[model samples]
Target: MDNKEYIASGILELYVAGSLSEKENEEVSALIQENPELLAEVISIEKAIVQLTAAAKKDATYSFNDIKNQLKDTETKVITFPKPNRKQYIGWAAAFILGSTLLLSVLQNNSLKEQLSAEKQQLEEQINKSSNSLADAEKLIEVFRDKDIISIPLAGQTVSPTSYAKVYWDKKTNSIYLDAKGLPEPPEGKVYQVWSLTLDPLTPTSLGVLDTFTADVNKIFTISNANQSEAFGITLEPAGGSLSPNLEQLYTLGAVAS
Candidate 1:
């Protein structure tokens, strides 16, 4: 609204350039009618531009009419540029379509590859689980094999007659699978120790103590027995079992028939 602010806004320069928007042109026209001083200032600036442009145009020597005549022949000469024929344009269109289709196909192939990888991993996990189940079943089958296995039935002693155990002695492997299905778990801090007894001298050799006695689901233990013995017995002495069978704590006794 102020005279100094209006001149500094550069809107007047655009008005002189004939570049002001239609709404701006009408507003400036209204302002010129109201402000005589602003109107006089615009006339003086326009006159100076007219004089400067005329002088510059005179020095150029090329008249606008001569330039017009030169432009008149421009269309007559018809300077042709090399452009693709219709076939070439069609070929380019086909190539662009093919390229886009190929790119889409590659992305779809990659997605399918990822899906196949996930399926392969799933199949591998399933196979591993199946293999484990098969191995466990095979182990159960081997435990009951009649050949090369001496089954020693351990009858419960006077202390507990209901508690029975079967020792499947594998002489070839020097190992025995003691199935203590009928035996009750010993009290806390106590374990059952096994012994190999020779009938003649009554000499005894200590085998390993049963581990995980309470938590064993099948209550079957595979123990090493490289001894030439006649009888087997189990005794509950302490948590780690005893060096010698606690005669007082003997639970079960069984003899191997000759």
Candidate 2:
């Protein structure tokens, strides 16, 4: 169970108030030991209640002392019966103090709950991102391990000397996985277009264009290529791919090794 959710449930408040069942109290106690923040919250709640109770007692004592002083000033002899008005005043004063303290506790609990909720949301987001990254890594690993997959290393061309990419082709599936991690992001209104080349007459077949190059984190793309490809080349083209290979803008090229 999520510790943040448990804390936000307001069970900790009830635990401090001694309103939870014995079993529930034990569970809360165990949780507190595991989470220092939760334990701190419980301690704060308890401390606030204790301080309020102490302040109320001190105020009541002071009021009683003031009453005794006033009575002695008015008359030298002691009263025969206890003063009812004094008792009524003390009762009302204690009730008011208790109500205020209860109100403060409620507000504090709500504030803490809101903070816990925000923290929980942030934690969940981080977990989701981590899970997605792990899934992507696993998929890449599987692609690399396939025996039938032809691994082609495309070297950088004159346009981008440092740019490089790898193509993992599964001939049975007629699909290629392009790992473009080494390629630089295309400029605005431009994208990378991949081609399956037949070197005989140097004819190029459009495999597909990478529209999500900038957005893709791993820069891995899947493209279908049923052609008996002799070589693979990538070029920087307009948003939509050109009909023919733009040899001048070629970024990377590699031939299938016999």
Candidate 3:
């Protein structure tokens, strides 16, 4: 018969429980020694009965003595029973569960740590933005504190109706801070130059080139004007600026009122 039919006969469970005769046990052992599949099926059934017997007892251990003592037969087996690995199996199972729990906890902690790191980075960025805003306000306050600064507002000219400029000229210190935020950029290879003008002869003195006009974040240019200037005008000149002003390229003009 097949291993299934042999196992379904219920003889293997009886043999494992020591309920079979001596002759039947020898016959079953001989068949298991020849057929590996039959031996496997018999061992599976035997394991179930062994587990049930082990649970019925209060003690946590079962050695070969226990198996032989359960047989209670004079001619049951020619060989001794194998030692039970009850303690070792229970220890390994407990260790496996503990290791699995520890690994899961570590993975969960790493996920939380990554989330915290992202939140901390976002908070740092927010703090930096607020600090930069405060620094800008403080810088503006310092810029407006000069006592010798003469404020001059230049309106839009015919060339650029939207252009405007504010000049903070410290005549006593010979320094002028020009705010050209409202002005449009000059064409390629051209730059704006500041002219300190005299009203009587309409003569112009070159202060300096308004370099980095577009690059300045505040759009405020600080220049030195040592001349006795009555008016100021902005003209687009070549890259390095000219020795004098070009009226044709004049963008805006305003007189320094007394």
Candidate 4:
């Protein structure tokens, strides 16, 4: 047979897989030595098998020389038969190896698809989170630029001389955005409380408590306030917040412009 016809017959694949009889193996080995093309084809088949085995068994190691040695070391059993068709035996062996290799390829492809799907989902979630944060920041910038919105700077008090905060009061919406980025995290079992103050009688109304201070990424909070606030104050209080402000624990205070 010509080189192309012999290679296409699939006997070389069975030879590389160590499925041929002793006499057949000797004949193939002699042919391989005489023809470089046949030797190259055998090496190519061995390499493909090594790659597939290595991918399926990630922790295992394989080498071309190992497969070559296994081919030489294979022992063929001589079974007594009235009339054994050597061609039929070799063809069946080649078909079985090809089917197994195809099955392995399919399984590996499925595993890769599942892994890619999970990674794509995680990437999409991260993108959505970043987009929402950007939208909120844009809205805040617009509010700060409004003509009716009040901007109040609360300076540090005696309790925390280096701390400061800012209040952006949207009176039309009765909402205030508090930027408490300058303040330190409160101690355990304690929280920061915001108060709207009236200076005439010095009456203080609790706006809300910063219960999520440590967990807030930007140190910014939104609170609803409908009181006629003449001033703003922040003080450290117990976990659930107090009905009244603690003057001694005041961290920052500011007066609203008339």
Per lDDT, what order, best first?
Answer: 4, 2, 3, 1
For model 3 the TM-score comes to: 0.50
**Cα lDDT tens digits for candidate 1, 98-145:** 887799799989989999999999999999999997897688678778
lDDT of each: 0.83, 0.90, 0.83, 0.93
How high is the lDDT of residue 127 in model 1? Answer: 100
What C-alpha root-mean-square deviation, in Å, does candidate 3 show against the real structure? Answer: 26.6
Error of 4 at 232 (Å): 0.4
TM-score (C-alpha, index-matched) for candidate 4: 0.65
* Candidate with better lDDT, 1 vs 4: 4
Better of 2 and 3 by TM-score: 2
Model 2 per-residue lDDT tens digits across residues 1-258: 687787788898899889999999998899899889999989998999888778766433345766773564455543243344766777866776688779978998998999899999999999999999999889889989999899999999999989999999989989999999999999999999999999999999999899999999889998998999999999999999899889999999999997
Clashes (candidate 3): 0
Candidate 3, 167-243: lDDT as tens digits: 88887768888889888988889999988899898899998988798678778777888988898889889999999
Instruction: Give the range where candidate 1 is weakest over 10 consecutive residues by summed lDDT.
Output: 73-82
Angstrom error at residue 125, model 3: 5.5
- Tell me model 4's lDDT, rounded to 2 decimals: 0.93
Off by over 4 Å in 3: 1-129, 141-147
Residue 11 lDDT, candidate 3, scale 0-100:
87
lDDT of 1 at 46: 85
